[model samples]
Target: MTAVIDKKKCNGCGLCALYCPLDVIYMEDGIGHVVYPDECWHCGACRQECAKGAVRFEFGAMMLAV
Candidate 1:
């Protein structure tokens, strides 16, 4: 899955970049962006930490069964 950043929602918080285990996300023009969307491992760590909900899945996600 690819991670998508909503330019309008991004606040340049740097949370995605910090939480990214593969270092795929980064900041640009005071906004957060996925530098390497293909490198994302679908770990969902960034999605949980992002306050703005800027990062999203492009291919849709499964509802993890509890």
Candidate 2:
């Protein structure tokens, strides 16, 4: 499983990047995104920390519905 970044909902706040304990998130083109999907430990930290409701998880072909 991995975290997903919704481009439409993201405001480039960097909250996820700031909150991530693993330093997994970053900004590109003024958008918050995941840098290392494989490095994710599925801790659900970023998903819960995202204030704008932009971060979520995807397990295989099924995404965890927010």
Candidate 3:
């Protein structure tokens, strides 16, 4: 899984970065970015903490299969 931040919806609150348990998200130029997608635990903490609802998770095709 990977976290994708929508720039239009993001308000640069940095909450997503702060809430990421694995430190996968980072703040740059007042915007939250997924710097380490490979390290993501798919815990959804960042998405839950984002007040603007700018953070979203994208699962690979392989991951979608049960």
- Regions more than 4 Å wrong, model 2: 61-66
lDDT tens digits, residue span 1-66, model 1: 678888999888898889999999888789887888778999998888899988888873443432
Best by lDDT, which number? 3
* Model 3 collision count: 0
What does the lDDT come to for candidate 2? Answer: 0.84
Clashes of each: 0, 0, 0
lDDT of 3 by residue, 1-57 (tens): 788999889989988888888999889988988988889988989899988989888
* Model 2 C-alpha lDDT per residue in residues 1-66, reported as the tens digit of each score: 888999999988887888888888888898888989878888878888788899888785445553
List runs of model 3 lying over 4 Å from the truth.
61-66
As for candidate 1, its clashing pairs are none
Give the CA lDDT, 0 to 100, for residue 50 in model 3.
87
Clashing pairs in 2: none
Can you give the lDDT of residue 1 in candidate 3?
Answer: 73
What are the per-model C-alpha RMSD values against the true structure?
4.9, 4.2, 1.8
Each candidate: what lDDT?
A: 0.84, 0.84, 0.88
Q: What's the CA RMSD of model 2 in angstroms?
A: 4.2
Clashing residue pairs for model 3: none
Better of 1 and 3 by TM-score: 3
